[model samples]
Target: MDHRPPTIKEIARQLNVSVSTVSRALSDHPRIGLQTRLRVQQLARELNYEPNTQAIFFKQKKTYVIGVVLPFIREEFFSQAISGMETAAMAHEYTILFGQSYDDTERERKVVAAMKKQRVDGLIISLAKETRRFDHLQALESTGTPVVYFDRVPPFAEAHKVYCNMYQGTAELVGWLYGRGYKRVALINGPEKMPASRERLNGYIEGVSRKKHKVDMQLVETTDFSRDSTYRAMEKLLSLKHPPVAIISFNDYVHMDAVQYAHRQGVAVNKDIVFVSYANLPITSYTAFPPIASIEQYPYGQGEKAMDLLIQVLNEKGLPDAGTRYYCEELAPTLVMH
Candidate 1:
């Protein structure tokens, strides 16, 4: 068995038809008779004929592969997201090439450049915290590849965005804390540039607005969204002029770190101070004293929706000239109490 890629010429020779007829029939051109199309398609499949991608791309002006960009694959959130994307891609008969930027702009630029040369059909991205310049993204889109921004999307990109209801989740957590009779509230947030920080903060502000509970801006500590930074920031916040009666962390990682900080200071959460964290990941539940409350975001569902919408665009051969917007799917987060 010759394992080399089969060509249209071989199929045409075996079927006793001109190469032009074979090509048109194999592509299922409507003008070609159904019987002719079926015969050519059957032979093409039997020969496992995969047209030369470069030439076929020149003809169809599209590639079937998609590029996926994520901030950190090590995080369970992206792990679940990527898994959903892979499942959807398989159903659509499309391939996904992924890159992890580790939250570095320069590293992300390199990956984008390489994928550009690969001629990926489109892009699906969950932005990194350090991604500030939209120029690279614009350049890739200018090449006529559609882009779908998923969780942690660009702050200002008017593109198809699939994201969680962070605000509602945050508000829910904050309301739960107040109901628990925690007067003072503190925040250990992510890097100020990321969009999640703003939304989560907004929810906190809105939730605590009616109550006389004054928001101690001094108690709001920001870190690089890393475990060490979150822990250090929590330590500083706890050593404040007036420690919070209740503290809310950015997500599970922040919750875990803040809990560790409290442990070091001989404080027991839900006893001395109630704690609520967003993104109730599995690891958070396993901790000695998990977050008093958490936001159970749908990472898997988000990934699936992003890829499904992208498939609709891909199967259309190409998206419209003007960029499209797939509105954010509103998913109410689950409130998990530890």
Candidate 2:
């Protein structure tokens, strides 16, 4: 009449063997004979016995869980990154706990605090657009919990990071535009507070300077990476005394706003505007008015590499030596032209 799951002790009693023998057999310990281990495993399977993860975690002082914090998962890049993380975590018998901040700094703080409360072994994070401070992340690291930041990483140098080379990507895109005879290029950038945004802006400036083109401050527009903000920015850019012959968007999602506005205004994209941006989703290729080209950031690869580095950090015992250099892996972005 009992509905409780069978325990190792019950399995031992049923097999008429010592508890240690049953435990060793279940674990496939080399000390246990093959025949006996097989018998114990078969019987354990028959009983639908599941190992107690809580007990195992307690014994080893490990949760075997990694927490992932992101701005949001609706974006294709973050979702693909999570897929990569899941693959790597599964291979090592670890699980992932996910949290989305929705680009809200307060919400991000709460999500990170909750993850800490859960006693996660490690953390992978992409900072929120509004997160200007690193106190929350620094507090976690001070507790000896390893953190790996990707995509929208902070200015912190001590923590591990995995990110795309946005500076190079932006520079190459701008140079290509100029080479194609597009002289006046406008940049619809994300918030200036973000390091990636600053890198892209710097690249834009450098590219223009390299081409001996005049840098027009009016051509640069900053936004919060919102649909409404991007649409408004595009409107302002087009209404300029001399609008740009080409435009570089902050990212593909923000570009969608510009595309929609262009459609409503009967403006022919790629031909009329010559848009370019960073995109990893397949949909970017199929869009009726796709950008002239996109920079492939390889979100999945970033996630995989981040997880690998985090696991390695977790395995190393003892505190890191003071002023020790940590790991930073920067992946190159490839240009995919339509």
Candidate 3:
């Protein structure tokens, strides 16, 4: 009547052999005789004896599990990235432990702590919007846990990171706008503290200079990537003495918010004021007014590369000078026209 699963000790009892012998035979250890191994295998199949994977993983000091943390999975960009990471992890006989920080720094720390408690082999994360201190992340790395940052990475370069180069794409976006006769372009950028925001700002300047147009700080606005914040930014831009002919948002989500605000103000989306953004998310295509062009950051590729880099780091953990090495990969983004 007992429903307990058969164990190696039980098998050893039935075969009148030592537990070690049963374990060795079950594993087909080279030291075990073929006849004994065959007997153990046959009994295991008949008795439905299953190896304890947790015990084996504990003894080997590897869970074969990777932790992934992102700001928001609801955003298609992060969803795509996680899909790529899952694909890469599966190829290596590993699984992913996923968490979302929800753009809160405190929540990010808690999620990281939970992952650490789970004893993950490695971690891939996109920094939260409010994350400023790297103490928690540094603590993880210091404890010999491999950590890889992707997309919204930290400001430092000493750590492993995989990200898209938005600066060049944003610059290209500006040039594209200029070519289409939208000379006076404005940028609705994210918080200035973000590296992504800085890249877009620099790109906007470079693109303006390339077109021989003077940089206009007045035309640029910063937002917290909120609906109300974007609406306020749109108000400020539209109130300018000389409003921009085109507007570039931090990303597709921001682009949608800006476009919606413009529409409410009786402004033609693609006519009176054009919009462009980054991420090139699929949802934008179905929107009533999508960006004329978008920066394709390839979130999925970044996620795959981040996971691959983490696996490499995990593989080289014990090698000489491996601790001192850091891997950084930057992918150049492309401009996709809607």
Candidate 4:
């Protein structure tokens, strides 16, 4: 028994009409008579006819699908962003395929290659921490497939990028700490290679200068944004000859690790040492002793805007104007003081 799904040809043969007529009728072509269209539709329902989407997409020269690449999806921040993207894609009658790289550059490269091979119309990416080279991304662009980068984007790429203004946010937080009479301020930043880390470091320097405070090289420590790294950084900072009265961590997760270390060392958080960091997740508020402040990057809003821009670029014919060849959207982050 060679059982298969019913096709348009079978419907046409049964109705004694041409295959072209059946297709036009099913598509509701204006040239097709209403009587014939209704009859074809009725017969299609009776036969449980299903159109071949692949064939349709091939003829239209569009997949109507987008690929998304992220460092990891387990984080609440990334999950919220994915929700925003899915909402937008649903409204546009499109589907998405996701790939996670787990913060590995080699894995990210391979995932991107797979998406390209799948012939996705466009790509959205939040670069992995280990990603330093842009050759793989550049290769995708050469194929005329548009890519929109969100948080943790490559600094040198000329593609459409959307990210939070971490520099300004960090500067404001630092100044706020100074205003509260915290003289000795310490910073625990992420990898120096990351744009976010570099920007935040510059912001810290600017804030110190703006407050007319002396810059203390001993107070600043760079980490890999890991729990162990942040804990060690916190330990080192507390052991300094003149420990800082306030600390700014890389993000909420890293800040939590530092707080735990402070608790173990008998240092009262938000009392002995004022703490601040980026990523104002809901968990921050539920903590027994939360940080003094945090920066809300609005990950969902970033994702929505990034996806909209990508869709806009996909619809545009030919190359964009010279002045608008590359687009960058920077979303403002709010300083949420607890």
Point to the candidate with the largest TM-score.
3
Q: Write the candidate numbers in order of decreasing TM-score.
A: 3, 4, 2, 1
lDDT of 3 by residue, 80-147 (tens): 99999999999999999999999999999999999999999889999998788999988998898999
- Candidate 4 residue 125 Cα shift, in angstroms, is 0.9
lDDT of 1: 0.81
CA lDDT of every candidate: 0.81, 0.89, 0.93, 0.88
lDDT tens digits, residue span 22-114, model 2: 989998899999999999999999999999989989989899999999988998989999999999999898999999999999999999999
Selected candidate, larger lDDT, 2 vs 3:
3
- Model 2: CA > 4 A from native: 15-17, 33-39, 319-325
For model 1, residues 85-159, the per-residue Cα lDDT tens digits are 999999887889999988888888888888899888888888878777778878987777777888887777466
lDDT of 4 by residue, 1-338 (tens): 74799999999999999999999999999899999999999999998899999999999888989999998898878888988888888888888999998989999999999999999988999998868898898889888888899988878747789999888988898889888899799999988888888998999998898998888978999888687888889889999999999999988888888899999999988888988888888878888778888899898888888888888888883755732488899998999888
TM-score of each: 0.87, 0.93, 0.97, 0.95
Q: Clashes in candidate 2: how many?
A: 0
In model 3, the runs with Cα more than 4 Å from the true position are none
TM-score of the candidate numbered 1? 0.87
lDDT of 3 at 136: 91
RMSD of each: 2.9, 2.0, 1.2, 1.8
